[model samples]
Target: MLEEEYQPRRVAPAHLRRTEPPEAPFEFAIRTARQSDLPAIREIYNHYVANSTVTFDEDAMTLREWKQKFAYLDKLGMPFLVAESPSGQLLGYALVTPWKPKRAYRYTVENSIYLGPAASGKGLGKALLAELITASKEAGLKEMIAVVADQGAEASLALHEKFGFTEIGRMGKVGYKFDRWLGTVLLQRSLKH
Candidate 1:
């Protein structure tokens, strides 16, 4: 897969600029994630692993780990979804896993969503999260949790709030990455069947 590049389009002078707004860069379709999609999914995730504090993990996930995760979620009947373009390039992915390993927490899950660099600022995250919520409801999950980064994840916080997630708590300086102290904001949404 080629690395996504930013190509700026030439803009007309203000006098000649069109009054209409521009359309999104591309359209995408959301579907259940297949084992074959793991590579692209891994690429999208590693982009964050290498560059951002959105995820606290310092090491990039290996494909073997992704396959294991896919298998585990499949066995548990959890929702794992991917957003693909018309030409079939994966744009992003979202999934939910058991919030805790104990039996009493079976009905609760933690949600995660990641998009490629080029896919941000579009409505893809919203679309993916909406589908994830529906899928989670169908899977009999009663609650969804979002652990968002306190510093660089404002958009993530807003997206979860748009879906009715409420801020439940926060942990200050709980993580250290990139030679700096970071924190997490905990948000939760109740899922109704």
Candidate 2:
């Protein structure tokens, strides 16, 4: 066959190209986290630690550290939740820790949520946050605070706000990461009616 016979005279412009519809939201169930879920949770969190400024930690957390945290939260009666697929795969996690180390701050807690890259943008974060908030309230927590990074964490900020967290304050140049100064946006929601 002649080479010229196989060539197309024109090609569709990028704008005219067809694209598939967005995928339906992935299905997952949100429930209280168990000790077995820490490995997956650590993987999700360390992704942000190593690749993004979502968490200020410059080092990856070991499984032992996660277990220590799990025990601490369990002892304190705090909420540590996970989202899982029907097949038992870990999708994401959300948890609450004491906002401060003082007894006076016992009624206030800070929340952290992390989703695996593939699990993001599919309603898992929202589901985890909703379950976390309910669990926190049931645990007698009065306030839930979210300390979201100012950079590369817009989705987190929006997710927290969607659950009624309001901007309480912002701190600039408080964290140095990836060879740049990073900041944090503080948000708080009252768990009590």
Candidate 3:
């Protein structure tokens, strides 16, 4: 694994750029996250924590926590990708992390996807998920899991299903947030060769 800084190169043509404006519902690009993206990522995540059940976290993570997460991902040699518009506004991010700390669990990872409010319903989630899945496979992972907050997050469940994830387990009332207990659904997708 290289520690070199990764830069995203423009792959779309000029006409395509005009045809697909970043703010438009259909425009998005998936690229590796950079240090400069921390602010936008924090804002998007905070919005969900403050208003949605997608994440069971009751409070927004501080900058230190976010930095620690980034460092851990780097140590794992996993990719953390951000969805952005052509103008470089981050709309979402997706990544995979170790499912368990044991060395025996090295081949298994957990998948995570998060989006800005404006990025919903535009296929950005699907795009990011597909890319993350492919990247995980290439990086030699054998299985991917999605641990979803089970307040009936239908869209997330459906998206994972579309990518061949199956419900493996469910924990009732394992997370407490928003003054209520939330269930957790564990979905798994196998990529073993």
- Ranked candidates (lDDT, high to low): 1, 2, 3
Clashing pairs in 1: none
Q: List candidate 3 segments past 4 Å from native.
A: 1-25
Worst 10 residues of 1 by lDDT: 1-10
Off by over 4 Å in 2: 1-25
Model 2 agreement with the true structure over 1-193: per-residue lDDT tens digits = 8878767646577798898999765788888899999899999999989999999999999999999999999999999999898889998899999999999999999999899999888888888899999999999999999999999999999998898999999999999999999999999999996
lDDT of 3 at 4: 45
RMSD, every candidate, angstroms: 9.3, 5.2, 14.9
Please rank every candidate by TM-score, starting with the best.
1, 2, 3
The CA root-mean-square deviation of candidate 3, after full C-alpha superposition on the true structure, stands at 14.9
The TM-scores of all predictions, comma-separated, are 0.88, 0.87, 0.85
Instruction: Please list the residue runs of candidate 1 whose C-alpha ends up more than 4 Å from where it truly belongs after superposition.
Output: 1-25
Which candidate ranks first by lDDT, i.e. highest?
Answer: 1
Q: lDDT values of the candidates?
A: 0.95, 0.93, 0.87
